[model samples]
Target: MNRLTVRAAIHVAAIFAIYLSVAMLIPAAVDLFYDNDDWQAFAFSAVLMGGLALAVALATQGRPPPVSTRFGFLLVNMLWMTLAVAGAVPFMISSLDLSLTDAVFESVSGITTTGSTVISGLDQAPPGILMWRSLLSFMGGLGVIALGLFLLPFLNIGGVSYFKIESSDIEDRPFERFQIFTLSLIGIYSTLVFTCALCYAMAGMNGFDAVNHAMSTVATGGFSTHDSSFGYYADNMAILWTGIVFMLIGGLPFSIMILFVLRGHVDALRDPQIRVYGGYCLVFSLVIAIYLTVANGTPFLQAVTHSAFNLISIITTSGFASDDYSLWGPFAVVCFFVATFLGGCSGSTTGGIKAYRFLILFELLANGLRRLIYPNTVTPVRYGDRTIGDDMQRAVILFIAAFLVLWAITAMLLGATGLDFITALSGALTSLTNVGPGLGPIIGPAGNFSSLPNAAKWICTAAMLLGRLEILAVLVIFTPAFWVR
Candidate 1:
């Protein structure tokens, strides 16, 4: 990337930092309304972060610089890290008195929509911190939708180029320009959050909890207001059903949602990835529900409800838990662990090896087996109506391989910090997948990450960033070729 592009990316990040600082005031006001002194922490953070961000933005001000594909990766990494630091400031100075490591861990988790937290006593925590967490998730979710739709396809990260072609080929595109499309995206996103919030309120959550959960649910973020998460409302079938519906929506492709909502393109909902994602959710939910009914002897309807909620939460990487599936025997534990890696649709907020990649991988495997049988078989791998390209196949295979390698490496690092096997393994998987709650006792559904060593927290934080960026985007920057002119 050119010097001009670097400056432009920094400028954009600075402006984002300013917006983040302003957002902090919402929580600050909440704290003030609740008569909590944490408002002071937010005030100090907003002023400090906003002032520095303003200076940087002013220094880099100029005509819009040309954006290169290389610069897209840079801008994304820079923006996320900058906003995470900006988000951490309040936590550092808040009444909770978190260490810098803990604050950054919470902040990174929120911005990545990872939802892994270090703080405990969330049921009675200050409103400011809680609001800040949800806001970060909300913003992070929006930012990632834009990233997946606009940047990843153009950058051709992990076979996402297929989406760019499909989107561009549409004769009646939703919006003619990027700015207009962004506005539509935001409008649709805000509408979803609003609807979810209203449903939560009608289901008996107070306004604050409803709004916070609405943000988290729509983001597929899973940052609950209470330590028990959805368990706090376990008996509230209304709320649980509401969450199930919205979380399913959160897991589907936002592009399809936009087209269906804005352009009345109902056929867009039939996209192959959508069908496959739905199928995965259905199959996993049913399997778990059956286990709950037969083995655990839970009531059939109750088992289905809890199983659907928790399984969809895991597959979507939403991480909300109504019951601890970890205690549901070895089979259930294995199922949940596998579901952690089955993230939702590619253009959505959820993370992990996305449903589309799995689709691609399966096609590749079948094609390979066919070639072995027929020797010169002429079968072209197909996804929906389109034939899969060799480039996309290679990208998908490499991405999955890299993901597993990184997960193993991260687990090793965590184990080195004295964590047990389950904690280290699931911690690595959860962080890389941006799925909150590991499988073990410490960081499981019932526990937070407060007890993890500082080094382990940092490792998880780095893994969260890597996972959020889809691994390759950040890893590519480390290559010698990336820096060459």
Candidate 2:
């Protein structure tokens, strides 16, 4: 590792420590008034984070001005993992009597915006603890946007090479442009949160609950202040529709959004990703709605609303549900299983295979077919107006392959730990993707990860890290070549 890499890692560590300190204050104050057990957890977490952060900064003070690329990549990935470990401190130290594994699992889930929770009975849980959960979702959502437009572009990670393509040739994008776009993204993200919070409050939720749910909802994370998920207000169609709208907004590309903000236009309707993502929600909602009405005997209007909410929630990898589709007829099961891979647009907070990849994959397959029909023809895959080269397609393919391999491995390993097939499989996929709620009795949409076996919890932790790091970051660090001078 070079001096620069050491400095960057230390800088990230220090920032985390600062945030942890600020976050702990709330719980600490809550402990004073409410005498909640989570207060102890936050306090302990703060101390651990601060001490380690100080040590890292001090030790790396004399490091060089620049580090090797390998070390830089490794440092970034390792820093996030380390932060997750520290973030778990509060949970483990709390009154819940959580094991280290469960704490880490919850931490990873939150920081990754995966929304998976090992805690249960949120209604009775300390408000401080629940607020921390929402804070994680908020930070993680913004953190993802920052990483996408800034860090990921810098690292050329996860097919972020597209950003470079979009940038100017002279140092690529101007710093001024980047700043404007970033600020607009923050505004857009925050505005959605604000709007949703207002609607939720008007829809009978308390201010705190409304804000928390809004953040998680916009982030496409399913961390609920209530145990029943969004179903707690099943009678409120306005809130459900409000959630659907913001969830869609949350899943769109920030870069594309800044155009309207910067240029004084409202052309969100024209964006290809927006159209594709919208079309996806519509089609699936229609199919699932019809199936529910016909096969499950649900009322047509209720089926349409429920199906739309659930389809958007899952396809965007949001994980929220007003009704658990698992209890629906077989058609609902099939619909959900297929929807797992239809992630939101790139540069959005939602996680999964991502819609663009599937688009490119199908385009590539179609090109191959056209070429087969005309032996001497040359065909290329394109996304929007840009022609996608082989390197980009290869990167997406590798990403999908690596993602699935990790999911399968984690599921198999969890199954070996005594989880049934559906539970293990869904748990592995959902946890890895940072999507809350899995399948089956133990960790399904109606269940929480709180009751999972310790061994299973640890596996979920690893999967969450792997998924959030986009698979390659963690894997690259482990290769012997990555460690070389």
Identify the candidate with maximal TM-score.
1
Residue 343 CA displacement from its true place in model 1, Å = 0.6
Q: State every prediction's TM-score relative to the real structure.
A: 0.98, 0.92
Instruction: Kindly give the stretch of ten consecutive residues in candidate 2 with the minimal lDDT sum.
Output: 166-175
Q: How close is candidate 2 to the true structure, as a TM-score?
A: 0.92
- lDDT of each model, Cα atoms only? 0.90, 0.76
Candidate 1 — worst ten consecutive residues by lDDT sum? 165-174
Error of 2 at 400 (Å): 1.5
Question: Across residues 29-145, which tens digit of lDDT does each residue of candidate 1 receive?
Answer: 999999999999999999999999999999998877676777888888889999998999999899999999999999999999889999999999999999999999999999878
Query: Compared to the true structure, candidate 1 yields what TM-score?
Result: 0.98
lDDT of 2 by residue, 1-485 (tens): 45466566766666666676667777677666776656766777777777777777666666444544575576668667766777777777777766788878877787788888888788888877787777777877787766666666565556554555432321433336556666777888898789889988897888878988998988887788889988987878878888888888788877666655555546443655667778888999999888888887889988888888888888877888898789987777877877876778777888777777777788888988898899798776887776887778777778888988888899899999999999999888887676777877788778888777899988888887777667777788888876666
Inter-residue clash pairs, candidate 1: none
Cα lDDT over the full model 2: 0.76
